[model samples]
Target: MIIKVENLTKVFKSYQRGNTFGEAVKSLFVRKPIYVHALKGISFNIEEGELVGFLGPNGAGKSTTLKILTGIMHPSGGKAEIMGYTPWKDRKKYVAKIGAVFGQKSQLLWDIPPVDAFYLNKAIYSIPERSFKKTLHKMVELLGVEELIKKPTRQLSLGERMKCEFIMAMLHKPKIVFLDEPTIGLDVIAKDKIREFILEMNRNGVTFILTTHDLDDIAHLAQRVIVVNHGEIVFDDSLTTLRNYLGVKKIISVSTMRPLPELRLPGIKITNRISDYKAELELDLSKYELNKFIALVNKSSTIMDLSVQDPEIEEVIKGLYH
Candidate 1:
């Protein structure tokens, strides 16, 4: 097994609804410890070389779970093993076999060239000189960060720095990689670069456990998605399964030659109506008869243009939480 987590739990002491002054006072005296069950007995097994997306909203224990897996934090209960090593035990040795890139945090020296940080990691990880050169060359070429690597991290743009970050993470060619919001602030091209790099690495037999707020990232890359909510695993399945469970609700926009009245149509939500010339409709695919809906709209006026799309993955996730 590449990763085996059984009944894993991480509890953090935090304050929840500290209401009364007397209650606060008592909390100070008795120290009312609120247990944040970050991972409530989460159990899953990731096979070798699989790329999986770990998804959750803010404070949903996604980061907490990753910290435990990477040996950055200790689990409060249960067990976790990555590549036959208990993540929290012998952390140094375990981590040497894994690479991590956390979007919110920077591991490179701000004022120095990115190559400096890359070399530092090379020395720290004790990579062989030949292997180091080979991997670094491949990463720089693949990520297209060769030009950016020579510049100080602080001088580079967000996207440029992100590319360097990715190269640094993979320089040692570790077997497993943990990426947290790898494309968080990147532009379209930068995001594409990171996505391509990830796919390339996975193709070369490296396992990846990714955490991100970008649903597009999950939709495009991950075949299997593990969704956590309120510190619990709410869903773990393929994107198709999740979409099927959510049902396919398509948004259709119709443009007419002239304006029309607000017509009450069955199984069609008139999300917006701008004069009689333009209207937007949110249609529930399961409920709406596709041809019937189309016919109804066609009868209204001469159709200028129309386009349809299912509700986005982000909308589906938000609905689940709500």
Candidate 2:
């Protein structure tokens, strides 16, 4: 395993305000700090060159776990190792071999163009001149941001800045990269571009751990998903396994050539009726075969158009939380 975590946990101390003014005034002189268990001993492993999605609802220990793994914060307890290094204990040396990008944060100089920042990173990481040029050239081409790199950071759009952020993070060629909400505010085109770059990079053997609330990102980029809730790991498996485990279902919409009568079948739900000739039905595959159900429907009506769709990825993730 390139990354291994055993019983990792993190705790934080915070203070709660008094409910009433009188109590608040009295408590000021005798403030009591409350402890929050941000991470409750979560553990998982990732092999080299694997792309994994880290998912959770808000305040579910997702960010806490990432912070601990990246050495930005220390855990209250447990062990974590990435590439044979203890993140917090060997901070400087460990960071040299890893890269991270938080959607709300930036590593580039706000006043300078991204190319200048890249050079600064090259110097900081001690990257050779030849290696730096080769890597930068590839990244620039992959992202198609040659012009944007020359623009000042403050002037670039959100999507443009994000693309540059990826360049800065990968300039050093870190073994593992941690991305938090990398596509948070991007449009369809921008999101597709970023997703493509991620796929390309993964194919070239850079391991990635992505944390995002965007289910589409998981559907498009991650083969494996680890779901966290209330400071614990709730689900960890391949996307296919998750769909199967959740008892895969599909929504089928049909348009008939003639007026159709109300049809009823076991495990089939009539969701909507656009007209006498058009209707939508939900089919539970675990209860019955889709083809069997469709054939039965076809016998009764002349099917003009039909479409089948798997449950949305958002629905699947929401099911995990429930």
Winning candidate number (lDDT): 2
Question: TM-score for every candidate vs. truth?
Answer: 0.91, 0.95
Q: Between which residue pairs do clashes occur in model 1?
A: 259-276, 260-276
lDDT of 1 by residue, 1-322 (tens): 8899999988888765458988777777576558777778899999998999998889999999999999999989999888999989979899999999999899889999999999999999998999999988988998887788998889999988888888888888889999999899889988988898899889999999999999989987897999899878888988887776677788888888766546676667888886668888788777887777777667867678889877778877876676
- lDDT for each residue of candidate 2 in 1-322, tens digit (9 for 90 to 100): 9999999988899987789998899788888889999899999999999999999999999999999999999999999999999999999999999998888998888999999999999999999999999999999999999899999998998899999999999999999999999999999999999999999999999999999999999999999999999999999999988776678789899998778766676778888988999988888987879888767767888788999998888878888899
Give the Å shift of residue 248 in candidate 1.
Answer: 1.9
Which pairs of residues collide in model 2?
none
Candidates in order: C-alpha RMSD to true structure: 2.4, 1.6
After superposing candidate 1 on the true structure, give the runs of residues whose Cα lies further than 4 Å from its correct spot.
15-30, 258-263
